[model samples]
Target: MTADQSVTEPVAATGAATMVDVAIVGGGLAGSLAAAVLARAGHRVTLIDKRAVYPDEFRVEKIGGPQLEMFRKLGFIRGLESVACPYDRVLNIREGKLVDVSVGQAYGLPYADLVAMARGQIPDASSLIVDEVTAISCSDDVQQLELASGRRLKARLVVLATGMAGALGYKLGIKRRVLAAGHSVSFGFTIARRDGAPFDFNALTCYGERTADGVDYLSLFPVQAGMRANLFMFRDPADPVMRDLRRDTEATLLRLLPGLRPYLGDFHVTDRVQNWVMDLSVVEGHLQDGVVLIGDAFQTNCPAAGTGVARLLVDVERLCTEYAPRWLMTEGMGKAKISEFYSDRDKIAADQQSLKMAHFRQALTSRNDIGWDVRRRLHFLRRSLTHRVDQMRPGWLAQVRSALRA
Candidate 1:
């Protein structure tokens, strides 16, 4: 995958040939959304990913909130409307005590639905090659890409949306090699019986505890009407308690779901359990010269935070909206302008993830910490202040309207 040592062949333009405005790597959620945005904006986009369609993915499900609005904007949210199971309320159980509960009957949409919608938005791409990006080279004027099937491409911009590809990015000198294998982990497991669970599917369930070592957080909610619910447990790898969670899942659930025993009574382990590690670090930097990183490649946040997909989608949407199309439409949109646009977005996407991570960590680890007490007190104060402000009833969306207008 060396820049100059590429095994590429000239790809004849299937029809009238034109250079691709943007070349995106790895057609996962991140790459797919970026391609859709650019293509719909009338930019010639070539997207390459190695995977077979709808490959077996580990991220089983997720909760939806303000992010649904983002899905709507991307035009990928429609298909999910039917398959997405609705469970809006969140319950927080801490160290054998029910501490906080948000019962809003909110909805939960699966990752499958989200991806389906994003893919649906752009029905076709200039060259949606089902190949991997074997090589990438970029400079002030043009971006070069080498495909696994030996195709060479030139574009105004090349985006390295490949997930956690350190070797690839480092070889291109796009980023200094850094070990980001973090200790924060989220493991998903399933139980056999769920129909009679003492709890209703209308509310989501979460349990958290902060030990002397670190944090442990669990999320439980129904995925579909007849199908069983899923249990997502997140723990810091550095914490000793997490080492044995897989062996002690039943006991852990027993402790957390005592009230739901009536519903869980008939369930026995009938499915093979599966889990994957989560990284908690953000990309050190977002861009350099010819290449840019998006999605998990940029900021691999804690999954419990569930902001990875949302932030990634927003990044592509904003970039395609404010930058990509205009670049292709004009004759002189060059490296200087592209560089500035990418630099600004890189900082913003990374910072937004940092802020969200802070709130998530504070909430999920406060059970046995003095800092948690501070977090709760401050959160309550903020809520109180917000309530008072709402009483004033400013009908004006102007504060934001003016910024958007500007």
Candidate 2:
């Protein structure tokens, strides 16, 4: 466990109500990380969740880029390194030809492990309670919660990180306005060669050949089990091809992307097929008294765009480190104070960028107009050309670009 330095002393919810400075109502990534951050800062924090441990969910299994930087800043990079499978290179291809190569640090692990890692960082493990928050009564000064186990909790403020489970938020007049329902479909499972040898590439990404297929891309990366694959598509959930992909994964994948056959080299799925139909949504009327929302609880992201972690990190950083602490110093937790987080420049930018990337990926994969066709070609061509130039010049181009910016 990455959080071995921290203790795991469970806080039992007893007969009477417990009081804390802050109470977070979700034990997932955002809530857990917030609890750890606040508790480490010597705040009286309580984190409540229905499940004691996060299940092996097929969601956001990889973390990299600015997400890694945020984890480092929040003091979770060591823990992440302890549990994640690290890889630094990804070979990008299209139509069986090389497009480019991406070089950066990334980690692959199950979503459950990531949550556990974050939860373990709480300085006082007893601050975490395993229970469901049935109802909440919010005010400017104090927030009260009713638990399913018949216990109560009172706090100065509340953090709603319940994710796509919006029933609790709905009760508080917080509603999710769906931007796109069934926006995309994603499949996750492990794969290994039939002969049991390792794959040649460290990581690989294969883009769709034609727009009609609605196949965005197939990403193969390393995980603890083996090579993990995440296939993203913009097709309808009820499409028969979805069944084919689930039942005859390898064959159907080859049929849709014949170019992938040579790279795969007689591979077979090593685990049960897990998939999700994503919806692009944002919570409206969330700026309420005594509470604020973060992560998927605020807005959901397109898995194909790979912006979920980035947005959530911005939320956690702004809320826990900046807004929450500052607000706690003052008197009340009214909508006037909570609205600052929603209007933060960085948080708003991240949210908008996630939506923009969602549309861009969908159009890049499925748009059949002449403009997009030309764009798709130019996109791959530009990347390929840049990769070639970088391969020849090594760090020279980067240095020149940096100097130019200066």
Q: Would you estimate the TM-scores of all the predictions?
A: 0.75, 0.96
Top candidate when judged by TM-score against the true structure: 2
Runs in model 1 with CA error above 4 Å?
1-18, 95-113, 176-181, 192-199, 210-216, 225-244, 255-270, 284-286, 332-335, 343-350, 353-406
Question: For residues 1-406, what per-residue lDDT tens digits would candidate 1 score against the true structure?
Answer: 3222232333543433236888888777788788887787777788776643545355637647666677677666665566677665665554444445554443544455555555566658335666666666767677777665556778877777777766667667545333335435566555555454544434545444334324445566656533334544444555554455566666555554454454346555434445567655555444566566777676665565666666776677767777666665666445566665656765475557655774566454534568776875575456445544544655334355688899
TM-score of 1: 0.75
Give model 2's TM-score versus the native structure: 0.96
lDDT of each: 0.59, 0.91
How would you encode candidate 2's per-residue C-alpha lDDT over 324-402 as one tens digit per residue? 9899998988989999999999999999999999999999999999999999989889999989999998988789999
Listed per candidate, the RMSD to the true structure in angstroms reads 6.3, 3.7
Error of 1 at 371 (Å): 4.3
- Identify the runs in model 2 with alpha carbons over 4 angstroms from their true place: 1-15
The Cα RMSD of model 2 versus the native structure comes to: 3.7
Lowest lDDT sum, 10 consecutive residues, model 2, at 1-10
